[model samples]
Target: MVIVLDFGGQYNQLIARRVRECNVYCEVLPYTTSLDRIREIAPKGIIFTGGPASVYAPDAPSIDPGIFSLGIPVLGICYGCQLMTYLLGGTVSKAPVREYGRTEITVSDSSNLFKEVTTNTICWMSHTDYIEKPAAGFTVVASSDSCPIAAIENTERNLYGVQFHPEVVHTPEGTKMLHNFLYRVCNCNGDWVMSSFAEEAVANLKAKIGDKKVLCALSGGVDSSVAAVMISKAVGKQLTCIFVDHGLLRKNEGDEVEEIFTKQFDVNFVRVNAQQRFYDKLAGVCEPEQKRKIIGEEFIRVFEEEAKKIGTVDFLVQGTIYPDVIESGLGKSAVIKSHHNVGGLPDYVDFKEIIEPLRNLFKDEVRKVGLELGIPEKLVFRQPFPGPGLAIRIIGDVTPEKIAILQDADYIYREEIAKAGLDRSIGQYFAVLTNLRSVGVMGDERTYDYTIALRAVTTTDFMTAEFAELPWELLGRISNRIVNEVKHVNRICYDITGKPPATIEWE
Candidate 1:
């Protein structure tokens, strides 16, 4: 197994994803993990993830210097590289020009670290400091125009460092670089796969929750669904899944999820209809982040009340994935969106422990695990829905009338997409109920109704998404059906905004 020391970089989990993509088992641990724990895991190699801090910062994270002397191969990335250099008697200083995007690098040495690396290659660099010179026993492997010491290596000790990120998609050869390090330097057998993950996860779950009652918060999303199935398999009837339908879900989603959990799966499933409770709490709330926080806190309260009715549960299982954990700034990443599941557990919960089975896996990886756990393909590959449900999709105050209109429109859009055999092609496609209205003449009559926005994005990893170029005919069909069938929405417009400029959801 390989271990990644996370230093709070955004791509820290991506490094684990790439390593798993190579069929090499790996997990990311905190940077402050002691050397004793590193020796206990006995990983084939160690990867230090990039961080958003300079090595010289007063409170910057640092690893024990004894890690390098353990005879295990070590690869340090952006901030990791600088930390390694600073600890090994090398110099790293602030660069005159900060590098943020793609840059060209020329390979000076071609053997160990740069096996298939071309002489001139493009790399993704995001750093404010650069190594002025290599550490005492290291040799410079590659250099770029903006940064002099782009890559450094010490063959004798099997230590390597790179100033650029090889995990992000910005670098074309990023995966290849990581592959070389995995196979050539670390000597990993490439033995890890989803099947192996399932076997280990089941075993770990059994060990963790031995005959203890565990209640899972199933949201029917890939993450929660996979977690529910996994825990059920581990401790049969000891696991109970309580799905909270808080009125903000998509059209008929509550009933659909209930049918599956109750009829399809053998796990003990409880469907709680708390729609009125959410409606009362979110009556006047309009701010997006505030809506998320309130929904998160309310979900916990509902779950605790249900647990009390069902006796006592020792653990609370959540489908908190790696992206949610990282983006919640659990490992020092900047707060992107305050995912409702990550940090909103109230202090008054009955469960003493929170078990997140898929915490280390990404979205795509979660789907893979879901399939491995024998879950239905349709449910496993379902489009990712936020924990806040349609609450975040609505621009302003949420109402039952607005929800019914949006639900019909969204259902029409999804049904048409499936009919066109484009359900799997588009990564995520949904309809948003914009709280704006436009006046239009329909059959010689002036109609002023709410406008609906259609958003479709085509992406592999959801980190960076591009707007899907849906055919004009399909868009016209969706628009016509919503306007003709749905009463409140008379106008529809396709959102052509990319993820960088505009998030997937408008609210």
Candidate 2:
């Protein structure tokens, strides 16, 4: 097992995900974790995640210097690298030229971390402070244009640090570097797999929820489906899955979800058609965060109502994955968006406790667990959908009219992608109902209507993503069909911006 210490970096979870990709089990704990706790876990390796802080700052996050003396291999990235240098009597100061985004670095072939990696390769760098000097006995192994000491290592002590991130995909060979650290340095056997995780999770759930009634928030999405099945496997009839059909889902999604769960699953399934309840609460709520919070709270209220009917439910389950938790401001990471299942929950929930079975797993990892649980591939690979549904997809207030329009347009967009045989390739694709309305000439008639924005991204971890470069011919077809078939949408535009500039969801 490997452990990642979070230093308030946005990519803390991403680092954990990368480690897990090496077929090693990893967990992220706060930097404030005590040395005793570290010794308890006895992790095979320790990783310090990069953060948005200067090591010299008065309030900068720090760790126990004793961590290095523990003899466990440690690898630090970016701020983590600077933190290691600073705590060990090395100089860490503001860089003459702050490096951000992709940068080329030269590495010595002797370092274990860069074992099979190219000597001169690109890496993802995002740091304002640079390690100016290495601590005593530490040798500089890598250098970049602006940063002289880009990578440092004390081979005898099993300590390594890099100014650039090897977790993000922008680094290209970053995975290979991580693989070297895990196998060559840490001596991990790569024995961890999804089947083992599923077995352990089921055993743990059964032990914790024995004879206790559990309620599951089943959205019929891959995450929720996997969570519900795992719970049912643990506690058969004791589990009840409550799916709230808030009017925000894609076209025909509500009915589709109901049909699948009721027919296929063995556990008790309840479908609450709370469309009007959600729409009423969301009336005039134009703010994205507000819409998410209202939907999240309403979902709880609906579940609470159902729980009362079924006596008492000791635990509530959500299908929230790693991306949802991190994007909702985990640790020091900025809140890019408030996912309905994560940050949008109410202050008080009626249930005794909330459980997220797939909390630490990534999107792809969840799919793997789903397959291990024997879930249908078609259901496991369903297009990723947010809990707030189409409300966030619509840029402004969500009315039944706007929902209908957006749903039809989004359905057409998805259908076209599937018809083009790009469904399995694209990670996520959907349509957004932008608030902008433009004047257009349709069949020689002057008309002013809403604009439809289409979004498609390809990603493995869902932490970082790139815009899918769709064929222009296919775009023309989707646009033509939406403009002609979906009413009230005259203008159709494809989102060309990537994740940094724009999220997959417009809101």
Candidate 3:
């Protein structure tokens, strides 16, 4: 396996994704990890991720230089490139002008890393300090106008460094560079795939939950469904899936979820229709977090009741992924805004253990895993819906009427998104119902009703997202349909803010 030494770069995960795209297995570890610990993994190659900090910083992270002596192939990225230079007695000075965007790199030698890549290629550069001199016994194989030692290679030691990012999609030959590293230098076979991962995960899960009954909370999304299926395959009757329909699902979603679990999979599925219970709990809830908390608490109560009927559930299975846990900062005890399943768990609630089978997988990878599990493509490629569902879509105090109106608006939004042939292209697309209403004259009669805000975001992970750029004609059609057909919504608008400044959901 190739090991990625993470130096706190945002693209660290992208590096891992690129490695996986080459069909080679890779795992990420903190830069502070010791060389001895690295040796235990017996990695075929190592890739150093870029960081935000300068190598010369007083509090910057550093790795033991001894790891390079292990004779394993090493590839250094931007900040990693600077670290390689500093650790190997090379010079890295603060750049006279910082390089931040696209730059052209000229390759002097195309034998190893740049084998299949063009001699002159566009690359993504983000760094303040630049490598000024090559390390001892290292040759400068590539150079750019901004930096002389743009790329370096120690042929004898199989150590390579690139000052620009090759993992990002913007770098055209990034995949080729990774393929060469995994295959040519590291001699690693491209054998890793979703099926193999699923097989290994099943074995590990069975061993971990031996003789223990596990209850999986199915949210009807691809993540939970895939998790439930995997757990069922591992534990069979010992695994029970409890689905709580919070009356926030889209049209026919509850029935669809129940049908898939019971008829198709032959899994023990407990369908609890607690719509009224959830609605009752969220009677006067206006705030998004408050509504999420109420829904989560009600869901737990329903699951708890069902679990009590069964008695003594040893493990609680959640489809929690790394992004969710990382963004929530579960370990740091960051003030978690009730995430229904994850953040909503009460402090007083007790469970013997929690199992997250898909914890290490990303959203797209989750879909791939679902496909490998023989799940229908519809579920695998379904557009992402929020955990709180249309509850968050209803801006004001949630009522059955509000839910109905929002559901209709949301359905229309999805239908139009698909009609525009942008369903698969976009990641998550939904509509939010705002409390404020605008006056409009329909058939010469003045009417005032709720305003529905349309939000569509394209993202690899929900942690960071950018609003989708829908065509003007398509947007107009959606707005017209919602206003003309769906009652209670007098106006429609799109959310343009990104994730940092504003979340995908208006609430």
Q: Which model scores highest in lDDT?
A: 2
Ranking by lDDT: 2, 1, 3
Best by TM-score: 3
Tens digits of per-residue lDDT, candidate 3, 1-507, equal 998887877787788878988988887777767788888988999999898888888877788899889999999999888898899999888999988888898986455888878899888888899988778989888888877888888889999999989998678887898798789889998998999999999899989998888888788998899999888888888888888888999977899889878887857888888888878888887888888767666776777777777777788888986555533533222323533463355443445888899887777788888888788887788877777788887877989999888888888998999988899988788888888888988889999988888888898756789888899999999999999889878888888989988977676
| Per-residue alpha-carbon lDDT of candidate 1 for residues 1-507, written as tens digits (9 for 90 to 100) | 899898888787789889999999888887878899999999999999998888888998998899999999999999999999999989989999889999999976464777877778899999999898778999888887778789999989999999999998888888888888899999999988888888899999999999899988787777888899999889988889888888887777788777877776778998889998988888988899999888888887887788788876799888888777767664444567866563366666677888989888888888899888888887887877887889888888888888889889999999999999999999899989987999987888999999999999988767668999988999999999999999978899999988887877777
- Give one digit per residue, the lDDT tens place, for model 2 in 247-299: 78888877877776677667998888899999999999999999987887778
Better of 2 and 3 by lDDT: 2
Q: Score every model by TM-score.
A: 0.90, 0.88, 0.92
Point out the worst 10-residue segment of candidate 3 by lDDT. 329-338
Instruction: Give the Å shift of residue 89 in candidate 2.
Output: 3.1
Determine the C-alpha RMSD for candidate 3 after optimal superposition of all C-alphas. 2.7
Where in model 2 is the C-alpha error above 4 Å? Answer: 279-294, 324-350, 395-402, 434-451, 458-467, 483-491, 497-503
Rank the candidate models, highest TM-score first.
3, 1, 2
Off by over 4 Å in 1: 56-60, 146-148, 280-294, 328-346, 420-422, 425-427, 458-465
Between candidates 1 and 2, the lDDT winner = 2
What does the lDDT read for residue 60 in candidate 3?
Answer: 76
